[model samples]
Target chain A: MPAPKKFSRDQLASAALELADEKGLDALSMRALAARLGTGPMTLYNYVDGRDELESLVIEAVVRHAAYPPRPAADWREEVRTLAESYWTTIRRHPQVVPLIVARRTTDEPTLEFGERMLEALARSGRSGRELLVAFRLVVGFIIGFAQGEAGAQAFSPAGGTADEVIQRGRTLPAERYPRVVEIATASARGDRAEEFRAGLDLLVAGLSAGARPASA
Target chain B: MPAPKKFSRDQLASAALELADEKGLDALSMRALAARLGTGPMTLYNYVDGRDELESLVIEAVVRHAAYPPRPAADWREEVRTLAESYWTTIRRHPQVVPLIVARRTTDEPTLEFGERMLEALARSGRSGRELLVAFRLVVGFIIGFAQGEAGAQAFSPAGGTADEVIQRGRTLPAERYPRVVEIATASARGDRAEEFRAGLDLLVAGLSAGARPASA
Candidate 1:
């Protein structure tokens, strides 16, 4: 008989995740993962098909770490808020994975479970068919997009520093040219991020209220 | 006097953008860009500091191509939709740049111009200070995030194909477990993306209507 497998898929996934988390997604490859695992690349084929499956595994590993609420909230909005927050927290822990998650749609159990739960809550909002789908897309877009904004702000902004530093820079911009941007930036800098996220989430839920009609449509 | 410059900043920026657009962002470098320009890396350095500045220039090149509305809409909502659509059109042409735009905060003139116009429209919503800031973030988050979702769906989804194909896959998913996801997939497959984006945008605007308040403190 063939020798028993040495590593669990979870174990292989975690190793791959570590490689990506440290060196970035581009640094991940079967050869690299094998090197990290102290094995040859050929040995890895026994577990994964190639880079695509490897990426999915990495996403699965990262998502599996999220601690979802023990029970769904009775209110659909609240359920969305809870799930969104849980997802935000989870992604924050693995900021490097944001691009991968945003770029690829994985069929991984953990990722799908998150989507299923959020969709369940959205369905409860009394929207069905195309409306339900749009709502789902909106929320998903916000959750992932919001994460991108925050992560980008932290990683990319040359002015990315303490809120105080950011606010200070905002105050210094030429008022005539960027009046609104300056004002919003200064004020937003003073506000708590958690509060901002909550407010934004509330806006999405409120916008979907029964009476509101699509302005463009 | 130093030799006359052979390339304008715009020309250099275009060459770099083409490099990134044709190859992935990772393929862009001083050496490579210079080679494309039929010059040495030192000559290229005279125009740009390095990859960071090169990237900013590339973004500027792309954003400059976006033709903003000659005039802002009379209503704040309409203004937002117009600007959002214009920005969307420009970025969709360069889908590869989405990650760069998302990860880095650029102060390029065109990028800032886009932000300034959007902020001006948002300000007309009558939100001020912290409220205005939150509202701006909400809109910006949605705009960028929604784009990411669409781009990702097109580029990364294994089911990234015709609506009918996606719907067919949705139909085959185990209904008992992914009922809501399956439902959304089937219904959303038939809807127009433009309509979906508009509806999602409307949801955010309506959610921010005067009477609605935050559910969480």
Candidate 2:
């Protein structure tokens, strides 16, 4: 056998990330990662317990890169916005990780730290308990939901084409059967999804700040 | 060869759904699906163009079953609410399809019918154009986002245990850096995720009705 290779956990994670970027998330088995690292799968256990832990590390890394290292924040909304925007960009670039991010419960250090920072930022909003958790859910759900929507819309376009095809395809939608859909399709063909996502974000943030809590509760 | 099998597209979609339900979504392939149907992989092409078209049919079926046979609506909110709730339950049960649903831009007949119904419900809210599309995105996003959030939260529990284990695991989080997280975690331990999901949905619907549209918009 070749001399054993040495790699830090970060190095391992970076390698795994590249593998995911290249071959897709489902392709990131410990064996594949080990192969990518020029090492044995058994040796991979030194860094992680199994594929699950390796995935968590991968998720943590993606989230860390997405959140801009989570510095101390002045404005809760701005910080939250920054996190959301970064997440949007990160997911857009690395669509492969979207499923992993969605499916895995992130209990890793970086992700937890990021979560803590989000809660800290929201502390200013004065919603706690169920209200606090729900607020977090709303913002996060919106970001993820928007990203999925944008992805789906983009998938309709031919190569190097705008989402106009999605719109054009809808014009064939019978006017009587789906008037609203056709109209929206027309507007959406020429629409900027990024601008619309920001608008939705603005609305959610305003509403969250407007408060999901009742005074008596 | 054995007598050629004759199955409707719906029948094929149902089989595919069962395959997805049994195996994870990743395990789903034209080859695998054909095996499940006791047919050769080439036979699947007769029903679907390929894996992409097959996935659309699968998504359409899920959307159909989840939305309660797509009956004409009376209460817009109730119908919209039904769509979101059933979507939640369907995805929770068929967790495998979540990524497929997220990644595919579904324009299948059943799925489109459902979309038209959702748009019909939202038309009552008096928002259209980009605002209309954004409203639809918000509601859809919220449902998908909440489902994904709940799924991730449940992942923390030890296998074969209730999600309470996930909340219980949060107690070990250091209190200093994550007071809010710990506090929320403590509350979430005994919390009702379903109730919270419904609450969040109500807020988004209310916000959509309140209007994200400007006078000019």
Which residues of candidate 2, in runs, are more than 4 Å off?
Answer: A1-5, A22-54, A67-79, A152-176, A212-217, B1-6, B22-45, B49-54, B68-79, B157-165, B212-217
For model 2, residues A77-163, the per-residue Cα lDDT tens digits are 777777777678777666677666655556666667667777766666667788778777787788777776664433432121223
As for model 2, its CA RMSD to the true structure in angstroms is: 4.8
**DockQ, structure candidate 2:** 0.47
- lDDT accuracy of residue B38 in candidate 1: 96
lDDT string, candidate 1, B1-217, tens digits? 9888799988899998899889867788899999999998998788877667778888778888989779988877788778887887788678677767665556666777888898777767766777777776677777777666555533223435433454566666788998887887777667677788888877777766642243311
What DockQ, between 0 and 1, does each candidate earn?
A: 0.50, 0.47
